[model samples]
Target: MYRIGVDLGGTNIAVGIVDEKYKIIAQNSTKTKRERGAKAIVKDIALLIEDLLRKTGIKVDEICSAGIGVPGAVDTKKGVVTFSNNFDFKSTELKKMLKDTTGFDFFVANDANAAAFGEYIAGSGKGSDNFVLMTIGTGIGAGIVINGKIYTGVNGAAAEIGHTVIVKDGIPCSCGRKGCFERYASASALTSMAQNAAEENTNSELYKLCGGDIKKIEGRTVFAAIEKNDKTAGEVLDKFIEYLAVGVTNIVNALQPDVLAIGGGVSAAGDVLINPLKQRVQIEDYARFCELKTIIKAAVLSNDAGIIGAAYLDLT
Candidate 1:
């Protein structure tokens, strides 16, 4: 049998037809067009699913349950999207709307949590029962898995590690908080740091990479400069990596999971990010010389994690 998985994001809505093996056998996508309102978006989602099923020639009976990954807080039991800042959604009854529009029931979860479950079951966390996934992109998102299950707490909103305060009275966060760990450690933070360095150090390779435009600086800017031995870029990278380590060390100290996996575009740096993280975490983690340590690795799945994980939302 097949299952439908929908990853509803601010920019796009991706639909996947996944088989029992967790493979996305068929897929479809469309712009979310949030400006059209949530009702239109939900209608488009239904249309997309029907189109995929028709193209694949899969009858409704051949499909099992469906799941959707929302980029916000979800009330799983209530099947409500409590909040989604990216889409400006609040208390959206996504599951009910889908059922009404398409006559199919679905499970819903936070997109990051779904991806973490996907990684735990089929990617980097495959062999471990307890896993942690840290995705560093425009922001920082974490997914925690324990005993082979997503560790969403009482109201299914646990493991928001990114919001934890790192530096008291530090930078402001979009969440209306100050000194959030994500503000200091996310790839966005790195890019901002790089942009400042590039603007200040015109002679550095980073500035050249950005073509003298500070707005053009990105996560790779500092790394490119570091390769060329640019002093300012190296300094920026060091500070960013140190900030990343501080939060990771906190996770290790708090949860002590079996594996800690990194995900998102920044993870593309691979060893450039991992090697330094290893060193910083080693020196800063609570159990420096423990017999067993959390195995830090990169997530194997790049972007399809949400699809696979969402497809398996009813696995329990």
Candidate 2:
């Protein structure tokens, strides 16, 4: 028997067919034009699933179930998306729609939670029961896996690690809170830091990389500048890592998870990002409480984690 997973994102929707072993036998993706509205988006997903099953030669009866990971608040038990900023989906019965269209049992979960489960079961945290999967991209999102299961709390909205306060009155976050972890630790934060540094250090290579337009500076541009040993870029990265470590240290001290798996675009910095973060955890993570020896590592399933994890939600 097979299972289908759909990862619906702001720009694209990834669909995959997986075997019982959790290996993706066939995968495909299509652009998500959210302006087309919720109904169109659901239709697109249904079509993609149908096309994928045909391409993989898997019958509907041969599939055990289907799962969808949505980028928003989800009522998992009700199979509804409460609200989503990535698309025009609010109070929509996502699971029922898919089931009606494809005639398969379906499940729905928060995208980050799905990614976390995927990593825990088949990727980096495979052997660990308790860990935090933090995705540091445009925003920071986290999934808490405890006792070999995804913990969504009572309302299915727990593990919002990004909103954890880091500074008293520092940068403002989109969540209407000041000094949220994502404000300083995310890829968007790194890019913003680079742009601010470029403005102050006109002679820095980052200025040239941004074509002298601070507004054009991006996370990759800053990473490239740091690669060339640019002092200003390195300084921005150092500060960025410091804030990231501060938030992570807090998680370590509080949750005492067995591991912290870092994913998303910022994690691409690899050792440069992981090393200092680890050091900070050792130095300031309220170590007296739990002897925080939690291991920190990069996520193994880069892009496909959400799709694969969503597919396995039924098993969980």
Q: Which candidate number maximizes TM-score?
A: 1
Measured against the true structure, the TM-scores of the candidates, in listed sequence, are 0.95, 0.95
Model 2, global lDDT = 0.87
Q: What is the C-alpha lDDT of each candidate?
A: 0.88, 0.87
- lDDT (tens digit, per residue) of candidate 2 on 1-316: 8888888888998999988887989998899887887778778888888899788778888888789888888899999888887777889898888778767778899999999988988898888879789999989999999998888878777788999889999788778899899988888888888999999999999998888999999888887897889999999988988898888888888888888999998787788778878887788867645654789999989888898899999966
Task: Output the worst ten-in-a-row residue range by lDDT, candidate 1.
Answer: 149-158
Candidate 2: worst 10 consecutive residues by lDDT? 284-293
Residue-level lDDT of model 1, residues 1-316, one tens digit each, is 9999888877899999999887889998999887786789889988999999999999999888899888888898878988777786789898898899978898989999999988888899998978999999888999898998788787667788889999999999988889999999999999998888787889989988887888988988777778888899889988998999999999999988999999999898889889899888989878878999998989988778898888888973
TM-score of 1: 0.95
| Candidate 1 Cα errors over 4 Å, as ranges | none
